[model samples]
Target: MLTHLSIKNFAIVRLLDIEFSSHSTAITGETGAGKSISIDALGLCLGERAESNMVRKGADKAEVTATFSVKENQSAQAWLQAQDLEDEDHLCIIRRVVSKEGRSRAWINGIPATLQQLKAFGALIVNIHGQHAHQELLKPESQRAMLDESGHHDAILANVKKQSHEYNKLLKHLQSLLNEEQQRIDRKQLLQYQLQELDEFELGIDEFPHLEAEFKKLSHSQALLEDSQICLFNLYESEQGTALSIVDDALDKLSELVEHDPTLSAVTTLLSEAQINIQEAAEELRHYVERLEIDPLRMQQTENRYGKAMELARKHTVMPEMLAAHHQALKEEHAALEQQDNDLASMNENLDILKSSYFESAAKLHSARVKVANKLSKQVTEQLHKMNMPHATFSIEVVSNGEEKINSHGTDEVRFLLAANKGIEADSIEKVASGGELSRIGLALQVLTNKQSATLMFDEVDVGISGATASVVGQLLRDLGERNQVICVTHLPQVAAKAHQQMLVTKFSDKDITETHMQPLSQEQRIEELARLLAGDKITDSALENAKGLLQIQQENLI
Candidate 1:
């Protein structure tokens, strides 16, 4: 509930501070007295658009602050906690400031906030029903929303919305796949042919390097055999100065001098070891020469294998060593395309399941709305009767579109129909009802359907109502105030008299400035204000007595 409002340089309000209680409060004033200035300021604080014209003359900026007590408002508390804007003592303060240039800024709990955040948080605590709300009530969407609210169909509507979203998402994917069907077929066929070629080749990992080496060895086999024979002859088979014979001659000369000098003995030992190494090396060369042979057939076979590997590498646009990896990559791509085909095959069945689920939930919602519509129609008609339209017949028509149309709300179209007089056919409210009748019906719906907000503000919603009907509207608001804080701006004395508290708005103007002031009225002041509202500019003795009687009656009724 709103606990206080402070306005500065806002419209005609120069500086005003008004405190509110948790009950019905009536704001009354003469024409052009700026009765709605406070409401307008409160609207700005609730995140309404701000304009430069709202600022008072000569003021640089306009500011409005609204304070709410959220001790019992769990939704508001949760919102504040989620926003990290929670304050101690269960208090929520929203302030909006507009510069003279039409720039606006907002704060929640002293932290900077965006307008959307303020609007989101404001929705949980306050519901402002403007004087022209009846105009909005004419919309079919509004009618449907009211019906849904009355039925408490949030969970069911959510299910239907979820199902619809998923159905549309899958349907779009299926359409895309169908559109690309030919392209996918062509690509798949190409991939299949390429993969078949690669499969037949069956290139082994690291086999290309070994094949190249073997081809080189086979192609040079004759040259290799010739070189080995020459090396063998020089190392051991040469009869003149073979390496073994030279080493043997050196060892014999060193042995003959060993007895003359001990140093010669060490030299002889080294020479003997050298001779043994030379003999072994020569024998190994002889064996290699004997084994060396050239074969033309094996050389041709190796050359062909290596050439084929190189040709395939060029055809596949890969290095010879990378053919195996490239083959693996192509296989992976083909596998993914195949999986897409699989998904496309099963998508229609999935879409059908989703469509069925959506329709089922929509059907349940339609049933619930129909049931609630009947109850709501009856209750609103009863309220209309009390609001002075005794002959009014109200009904809510809920029609389903079946599978022809669907939306996030559901498949049901809700219409509010009314016949203001007897023997008149009930028709659409917008086509048949007058302005005053629309206001009454709109009020009835508001009174019946609004159950969430902690505070309800009716800004002259009783505009076309007066006399006994006005009194009934006041009483209805008073009843609502018993459960939630209610604020009403009205020119009707009967409505003002029924309030637990009252405030008077008066405009004062001088040569240079016009200011609007609002003050809470005392018991005597309330009677005086009510008398003025009843009798116009003059408050006669009878008007005073009538105002007192009205208050007296309201007090007795409360008991």
Candidate 2:
């Protein structure tokens, strides 16, 4: 329940602090006295949109803070704990600040919070019914929503919504696949042909480079043999003066000289080593000449293989060395495309299953709504009789033919019907009800259907009601206050007289500034305010007595 509200420099309110009662509280003021300003300030604290125009003149910013007791509100407490914003005192304090530049900021329990978080948390604790709430009640969607809210249909409704979402998602995918079916077929066929060609080529890793090397050797075999023979003749097997023979002759000369001088021994040793190296070279050359051969057949075969590799590389728009890698990539793509085809084949079955699940849940939701709607109609009719509509007949029509297109809210159409007189057929409420009648019906629905919030606020919802009916509305709110905190802003004296507590809004203006002030009324003060409401600005003795009598009657009824 809302415990306190502090507003600063907001609209006509300069600085106002209001401590609310746990039961019914009435806010009253004369015309243009800014009675709704407090409600607007509270709305800001609850994350409503703020504008620079809402700031008081010459003020830099406007600020509002609302405090709520959460000891009994487990949902709010859980939300606070989840956000790490819970206080040790079990109180939720929400604050909002709007600057003159139209910028806004909010805090939950002194911790910085986003506007969306404030809205979500605020919804758990407060439900505010605006003056024009009946306008929304006229909408068919709102009617359906109200019917659903009256019952415990959350689980079934959630299942239906989930199945509908999945069904739509899959349907969209299937449609897209069907639209591009020809393209997919063409792509698959192309991939298959390319893969087959690469598979038949039978390329092996490192085989291309080795084949090139062997082909080079075979193509130039004759040149290689002739050059090797020439090298052997020059080095060791020359006919004029073989290098081996020359070295032997030099060694013999050096050997004789070395006996006289030891320095010549180094020369003789070098000549002997040279003669051995020349002989080894000549032997190796002889072996090469023996083994060397020209084979046209093997060379032709190698040439053909190399040419085919190059042709394939050019055809595939890749280098010869990258052909193997490209082949693997094509195979992978073809496999994925085949998988997509398989999925397409089974998509319809999946969609049908989802559709069946959605229909079943929606049917359950429709059945639940029918039961709730019957109870709601009976309760609302009883409430209307209490609000001076003695002969009013109210009913909620829930109809589903099972042939309507699937939607998140099931297939049922919910309509609120009303008949103002006895023996009259009830028609759609929007078409047959007057403004006052609509307000009464809208109020009845609001009072009965709103059971989730800890605090319920009615901002001038009794606009078109007065006299006995206004008194009944006040009593209904007072009854609701027994279970939930109720705040009502009204101009009706009867309504104001019925509240356990009353606050009066008075506007003061001078040449430079205008400000609104709100204060809880004392017993005498309440009498005076109620008198003013009953008899205009002039409060007569009789009006005071009437106000006192009204308060006395409400007190006796409470007992």
Candidate 2 off by > 4 Å: 202-316
TM-score of every prediction relative to native: 0.79, 0.87
Over all chains combined, what TM-score does candidate 1 have?
Answer: 0.79
Number of clashes found in candidate 2: 0
**Candidate 1 residue lDDT tens string, 1-559:** 8999999999988999999979989999989999988888888988899999998889999999999999889999999999999988999999999999999999999999998998898788888898778888999998898788778788999999888888888888999988998998898898899889888877788788888888888888888888877777776778887777888888888787887887888788888888888778878877876876677888888888788788878998999999878888889989988888999879988988888889999999999999999999999999999888899999999999989855688899889999889999999999998877887888788788776556888889887777898898888888888888899999998888888889999999999999999999999999999899889998899999999999999989878
Per-residue CA lDDT of model 2 for 78-105, tens digit only, reads 9999999998999999999999999999
- Residue 302's lDDT within candidate 1 is 82
List where candidate 1 sits over 4 angstroms from the true fold. Answer: 30-34, 47-62, 81-85, 97-106, 111-117, 204-326, 507-515, 531-556
RMSD of 2: 4.1
Identify the candidate with maximal lDDT: 2
Alpha-carbon shift of residue 176 in model 2 (angstroms):
1.0
